[model samples]
Target chain A: MQELMGLYTKKEVYKRFDEMNLMELLTNSLKVQMKHIHIENNQTLLSVNDNKKVYFILKGIVAAQKDDELLYFRGKNHFIGLESILFNEESELTMTSIGRVEVIEFSKAEIVEFLMGLQEGWLYCYLISKDLNHLLVRNYFNFQAKPYERSKIMLNDLAKEFGESSDEHVLLPKKFTLAILTNYLGISYVTMRKILETLRNENFIVRSDKQKEICIHTKLF
Target chain B: MQELMGLYTKKEVYKRFDEMNLMELLTNSLKVQMKHIHIENNQTLLSVNDNKKVYFILKGIVAAQKDDELLYFRGKNHFIGLESILFNEESELTMTSIGRVEVIEFSKAEIVEFLMGLQEGWLYCYLISKDLNHLLVRNYFNFQAKPYERSKIMLNDLAKEFGESSDEHVLLPKKFTLAILTNYLGISYVTMRKILETLRNENFIVRSDKQKEICIHTKLF
Candidate 1:
């Protein structure tokens, strides 16, 4: 995967195959195929134990969960259903759409056949890039930290990445709900709520009704 | 990387290149090289900020650290120094040998050039397999669990995976030092020590002098 990085970006790798018009050439000669799928917001794309299907996300965010627990989220350019494909086991996590999601769906047999047809090494590059991206995000948090410390770090990161900033404060977007934010921090809802309450008491954060938007006080930091 | 899984194991992928005698064919014709190195235990293989070099572990374990904190351990068949190669940034973690180690070292330029010569997808498959293996081990623990709960779960998992079992107890290997075990659990040393003390007092675990090997009392579970 590291070697692939010095060669091409994931998108570029995918395009190299398309640019060759290998799709038309292969489909006409070989029988490899992919299907386009459109999923609505909150729709479950794949449930636990689902197998042999891999979704290449073209648009929108996908939430991965283990039963009731939210594991993480993947957005554009990420592939869902990899666990089942990689481990040759049942899907351990269920994946659902955050908004409307469009994907190119490939069955296990078709993907293997497609790679065989290419023999060009680009598909392998694309897969490694996707896995590297997944690892980067999952490795961002310090799992050893206490809940309060973890929450603070997560909030600071969110503010820097997604918040709208001014001199006094940075406003977190409405999309990052309490559930999503808390889960992303790998903390319980109650713990995160208490942490947020403490931050508010300390004049560090200002929250809107229903806790949709949060204003992180910058001066305090 | 998930896609690569249904294709070949990392070792199998590597062997595909060698078995083809592509090395002799290419080195004689195109000029590419890989170096083999032996590292002694506790010796630093790569320091923070070192770039462009990747190590393919042929034997023994390598410990990755961020300063004094143990980040994770990678053993045989894993690649060390991928972060620098993938991100095009300085290495974030320092890698050191845990035991006498053997590795095939490849410079970034040499590796990329070699892959280009092969025109085969096996190298890409190998890279993805490595990343997938890394992600699997890192994702094993529930980061949100309390330290006590986390330690218990980790201990149970360790016993199942690496411990020597008897009717009454399970003995953790001598290689699992307090530092290594606590760090792998992603808990503070003090917290892990306190947890162990409680377990011992409750007759759930027995420890030898200097805490070399821990015997988990099976009947308690």
Candidate 2:
């Protein structure tokens, strides 16, 4: 529970509720059941076959995948498995832990009941819809852009979001393999590998000896 | 008011409200003020420069456009200028009337007040959010598919939604011109025209010169 508080605080999840006047409703609706689980570097936390449940990442990193390809990574404070829960459908994408991770799970029945009881549940739903819409639009634009251009845009977004000012770089787990990059860019795996190699040789990114993680070398370029 | 009744039978709107479970709330929220305006073909109904107000199409066809390129043709029961109204932002798209049109306008202030007053307003908001998300996904998928393939998908959706069982044809207004189709498919104007011609020659669709409309030749092949 203490660890859960730290992760949620870092993620600003409850702050977001206050911004939308949904803190009370969300708190009352959610009964936090915390769990600790050890996941291998590439093991799935949740998959298409799993039942719908909302998961809040308490620690470590989890990457979303589709068709055996990595799509995106969610770190502490982020929530995943929302689409399946919202539509009451099977998960369309898989969530895999890039490293050992912990998460809090909320059942769909409790969520539905919570929403029904809340005065601001409708507002929360509307906000989620808006966020999903934005994601789709961003994906569309990314798909339309050239492969290298798309990669650059994604890297820039990540740099801005997760980059530490002192380091000017961010470490991404090896779980974000070439297959994941290709799936996200909607390009061929071969092309993605070639591009990664080119970027590495140019010093735009540095891959460790283990080749399981990457560090952006901002000053090199 | 009587003519307005013809545009959307109170029964039809009520049916939609029931499906959404907003019957009582919608009825209480809406303050009906009907207006009639003669709109010449291809004349602007709402421009990108216009003030933010949501309008419900009561009669005739209205086309939404961006940068002079037609995007969508909306008919009865469809709402326009909603994006601007909801976001309190300037219109990002222009809306034009394809023919003589009648609509009911609701100011954003009034609508917001009404929404806040209703207990189920959040439900309506959630539904709208869900709808916007769906539209974004549809647009993303459309852009991913080939131009011709995109047209086929659009035709199939239209047929399924509006086709007459006996005739096996779906009639669409001239407002759905080539420019609109191109915008919807996110393809070039020349490509959209070429695909339209190909479909026409292949007898996949038939154009009515007298009525100035297109009819699907059959269900999806």
How many residue pairs clash in each candidate at the backbone level? 1, 1
Global lDDT scores for all candidate models: 0.63, 0.57
Runs with alpha carbons beyond 4 Å of true place in candidate 2: A1-32, A36-51, A59-75, A81-101, A144-151, A158-174, A190-221, B1-51, B59-75, B81-102, B146-148, B158-166, B171-173, B189-215
In DockQ, how does model 2 score against the reference complex?
A: 0.27
lDDT of 1 by residue, A58-133 (tens): 7767876664556556666656665433333455567888768888776755654555555453444344444544
**lDDT of residue A209 for candidate 1:** 76
CAPRI quality of model 2: acceptable
Evaluated with TM-score, which candidate comes out highest? 1
Candidate 1 residue runs with Cα over 4 Å from true position: A1-42, A56-60, A82-91, A99-116, A119-140, A156-175, A198-210, A215-221, B1-41, B56-60, B82-91, B99-140, B156-176, B198-210, B215-221
Provide per-model DockQ scores: 0.23, 0.27
Instruction: Give the per-residue lDDT digits (tens) of candidate 1, residues B42-135.
Output: 8888885565677777777787666555655666665666443334345556788876889877675565555555545344434444454445
